[model samples]
Target: MNRKGAHLEGVFLDFPDLIGAYLNGTHLERTYFRWANLSNVDLANADLADANLEGTDLIGAKNLTIDQLSKVKTLYNAKLDPEREIALREKYPALFEKPDE
Candidate 1:
C-alpha cells in the first residue's frame, strides 16, 4: 500500500505483510510493528520515534538510515541488511536492547 506522508502514529500492526509498501515520509511515531514484514518497503524520511520494531523484517528496506533507526524504541531481533545492522548496532546499541534488559 502507498501511504507516503500519512500520519500513522500509535498504530498497531503486528505480523503485517507490508512488503514493498511505500511509506516514505510517513509519521509512524510510537507505532507497533512487531514481527511485521516490511522488506523492501520505502521509508525515506519516515518518523519512527518510539516505535516498536521487535522482530520486524526490514531487509532491503529502501532509504532506511541509521539516523532513523536510532530514534526507535527497540529493534530486538529485527531483521535488517547486514551492513546496516552492523552500523546501527555499533552506533545505537540501546535500540537493540530487550525491554526487560
Candidate 2:
C-alpha cells in the first residue's frame, strides 16, 4: 500500500491490471508499461523518469500530474483523461498519436 522507493525500473509489465494499487513514492524509472491498466492507481511522488508508457491506459489515475508525465521518456498511444490528454498534447504532441499505433 505505502511502498516508498519500490524498485521496478526497466521491467516488462505489459498488459498488467494494477487498478487502484497504491504506489506512492515507488521507483518506476525506465519501466516498460506497454498496455498496462493503471486506472485509479496512486502514483504520488513515484519516480517515473524515463518510463515507457506506450499504449498504457492512465484514465482515472490519481496523483499524477502533467509535469510528472512530461518527464517520462515515452508515452506513445497512452490513454489519459480528456483534460489531461489535452494538457499533455500541448507539451508532448508526439505522445498522442492517431489510431493508437
Tell me, by TM-score, which candidate is best: 1
Among all windows of ten consecutive residues in candidate 2, which has the lowest summed lDDT?
A: 92-101
Per-residue alpha-carbon lDDT of model 1 for 1-101, expressed as tens digits?
A: 99999999999998999999999999999999999999999999999999999999999999998889999999999999999999998898888888653
Q: Model 1, which residues run further than 4 Å from truth? A: none
Global lDDT of model 1? 0.94
| TM-score of candidate 2 versus the correct structure, residues matched by position | 0.88
Please, what are the lDDT tens digits per residue for candidate 2 over residues 1-101?
Answer: 45667888888887988988889889999898888999899999998997888888999999998988987877787889999989988888876553333
Evaluate candidate 2 by giving its C-alpha RMSD to the native, one decimal. 2.7
Clashes of each: 0, 0
lDDT of 1 at 18: 98
TM-score of each: 0.96, 0.88
Backbone clash pairs for candidate 1 read none
